[model samples]
Target: MAETALHNTTTSWSSDFKEITKMRLAISVVFSSVAGYFLGATVLDFVDVLLLAIGGYLMVGASNAYNQVIEKDLDALMDRTKNRPLPAKRMSVQMALFIATAFAISGVAVLYYINPKTAMFGALSILLYVLVYTPLKTKTPLAVFVGAFPGAIPFMLGWVAATNEFGIEPGTLFMIQFFWQFPHFWAIGWWLFDDYKKGGFAMLPTGKRDTKTAIQVILYTFWTVLISLVPAFGMTGRLYLTPIAAVIIGLLGVFMMYYAIMLYKKRTPKSAKQLMFASVSYITLLQIIYVLDKFIR
Candidate 1:
């Protein structure tokens, strides 16, 4: 009976750790990093892929842990985040802080061993996300813009890790992901606007889920589509996106834009939720298209 009880407690503890890490979101971020590495690397060996996964996870996990620590009280006030490890007391603040610091140090150290530029980029991402973006959210809506700066780094981090240098390809990778964040977060803000309000977070540009916010989503959506096609124009060097791939990726962007328009026109929570999900699908599919296009062409 004691062993059984211990097993249950251990499972619960593991679950809380996963929750603190925001595993799903971190995995996607890491995936984009791996994709970027695959694109920029001449070989894309197993070791590079393993390192990207480890480094990306620790970096993002550390950010999530620190974010939860900083927002513990605010998180308790929100329906979506109230049961989080920090807020619910599943993990003490000291424990979370220790874990966050350890993860961050390990993440940066690993990347430094891989390459200095990649390590510096990882350090920058953690500092920006935890130090800048976390505190800035409640202070100003402009935080989203600043937050995107670090949020957009992972996709390019992979490339720099492989090449050990910065180049136009990584820059282009960064640009596509950078522009994609506005509409993505705006849709999330629309759906969770009330929850954000409860926490005093001005996540939306207008601080309201109305026409103005929807228009901003559409504008960003347009930019995302346009910039995604730029690689097809022969400007991306050996990274040509090809005519068919560009057309298909362009159509996918159109689908995302259509949902944005629907949200703007309808101006309802349901429409916003739909757009939010669509944006996830759009970016994930867009990334897949990009990776596949490399093989196809």
Candidate 2:
């Protein structure tokens, strides 16, 4: 009986860790970073790629853990966040902080082993997410704007990891992800407007599910689409895309924009949800296209 009880306790802790770290989201972020690494790397090193993946995941996990700790009370107020480890009382704040600190230190150390610049960016992402964006969430609608800085870092971070330099190539990668977050997050905000209000979080640009917010989503989607094509024009240094790849990316952008427009016209929760899914697909496919073009072309 004691052994079984201990086993259950262990399993519970494992689940708590996963919830605090938001494992799936962290993995997705790691995917973007790996894709960026591939884009910037002319010579592939499997060891470096593995290190990048581990370090990137750890850093993202650390950021998420700290965010949960900071927002524990607010998280309990929202339906979407209420089941998280902190809000659910499955883990103590002290334990979460310990995990976060360990992950942050280990992630930065691993990244530093790769290169100093990579570690710097990883540390910066954590700081921005925790210190800046987390606090701003309850204060101003511009929290989304501040959050984008850290959200967009992983993609470019991978490029810096591979190239050990920050240039137009990584800058272009950063810009693409940076602009893409507006539409993606606004779609989430539109659908969850009620839930966010419960937490006193200012997520949407206009802090409401209105035409203005939808219009901003559309505008950002347009800009994201345009910036994505800059590489094809040979303006973004080593990040140039071929004509065919550019056409494909443009179509994907249009596909996402179509959902954005539908959200604007319909002004419904379902439309907002659809836009959110499309935006995710758009960004994931865009990264894939960039990496494939680099290798295949």
Candidate 3:
């Protein structure tokens, strides 16, 4: 009976760890960094790539854990986040903080082994997310703008890890992801407006779902589509996209924009959710297209 109880406890703790760290979200963030690494690497080193993935995941996990710690009360108020480890009372704040601190230290150390710049950016991402963006979430709608800086870092962080330098290529990569977030997050904000209101989060640009917010989404989607095509014009140095790939990417952007337009026309939570999904698909496919075009073309 004691052995069985021990096994159950172990399983529960494992599940709590996954929830606290937001494992799937951390993995997706790691994917962006790895894709950037592949794009920047002239010759691939699997070891470095592995380290990048591990370090990147650890850093993102740490950021998420810290975020939950800070927002424990607010998280408990939201339907979407109420069941998270801290908010659900499955884990104590001290335990979460310990895990976050360990992950942050280990993540930075691993990244430093790659290069100082990569480590610097990783540390900066955590600071910006926790110190700046997290606090601003309830204060102003511009929090999304602030959050974009950290959110966009992973893609360019991968490039920096590979090249150990900052240049137009990584800058272009950063810009693409930076602009992409406005639309992506706004869709989520729109869809979950009520849930966010419960937590007093100023997520939507206008702080409510309306014409102005929809217009901003359309405008940002347009800019994201335009910026994504910039590399195809041979302006971003090593990050140039081919003509065919540009066409495909352009089409994908248009596909996402179509959903954005639908959200504007329909102005419903259902449409907002569709736009959110489209944005995710767009970004993932865009990364795959960029990586494939580099290798194949």
Candidate 4:
């Protein structure tokens, strides 16, 4: 009985850790950074790439864990967040803080070993997410605007990690992801507007999923699609995309924009949800396309 109880406790603890850290989101963030690394790497350093992945995941996970700690009370008020480790009481605040500190320190240390610039950006991303974005969520709708800075860092961080320099290539990558976040996040904000209101989170630009919000989503989606094709113009230094690859990406962007347009026209939760998924697909597939384009052509 004692051994069985111990095993059960261990399993529960693992589950709570995943919940508190949002491991899936952390991994996805790491994926973006890895894709950036591959695109920017002149010579493939597989070992360093692995280190970046570990460090990126740890830093992102730490940010997520810390966010949960700060928003424990607010999280309890929303259906989507109520079952998180902190709100569900599966993990104590002290434990969460300890985990956050461990991840943050170790992640930064590993990244510093890779390059100081990489480490600096990693630390900055965490600081901005925890200090700036978290607190601003309930304060104003502009929080999304503020949050986009750190949110877009991973795409550029990979380039910095590989090249240990900031240039047009990384800047272009940053701009692409920077513009992409608006429609992506706003679609989620549109669908979850009511749930966010329950927690007093003014996530949407207009604080409601109405015509204005939908129009903003459509406009941003257009901008995002346009910026995504910028590298194909051979203006972004090391980040050139062949015209064939450009056409493929353009088609994908149009597909994404089509969903965004549907959301604008219908302005329903269902449409918002479709746009949200479409946005995710757009970014993920876009990253893959960029990487493949680099090697194939």
Instruction: Write down the worst ten-residue block by lDDT for model 1.
Output: 234-243
Q: Model 2 misses residue 41 by how many Å?
A: 0.8
Superior by lDDT: candidate 3 or candidate 4: 3
| lDDT (tens digit, per residue) of candidate 2 on 199-244 | 9999888878887988999999999999999999988888989999
**Best to worst by lDDT, what's the order?**
3, 2, 4, 1
TM-scores of the models, in the given order? 0.98, 0.98, 0.98, 0.98
Highest lDDT: give the candidate number.
3
Off by over 4 Å in 2: 1-4
lDDT of 4 by residue, 7-91 (tens): 9999999989888889899989999999999999999999999999999999998999999999999999999999888899988
What's the residue-level lDDT of 238 in candidate 1?
A: 60
TM-score of 3: 0.98
Query: Candidate 2 overall Cα lDDT vs. reference?
Result: 0.94
lDDT of 1: 0.91
**RMSD to native for every prediction?**
0.9, 1.0, 0.9, 0.9
User: lDDT (CA) for every model shown?
Assistant: 0.91, 0.94, 0.96, 0.93
Report the lDDT tens digits of candidate 1 across residue range 154-271. 9899989989988888899899999999999998999988998999998999888878889999999999989989999998766679899999999999899999999989998889
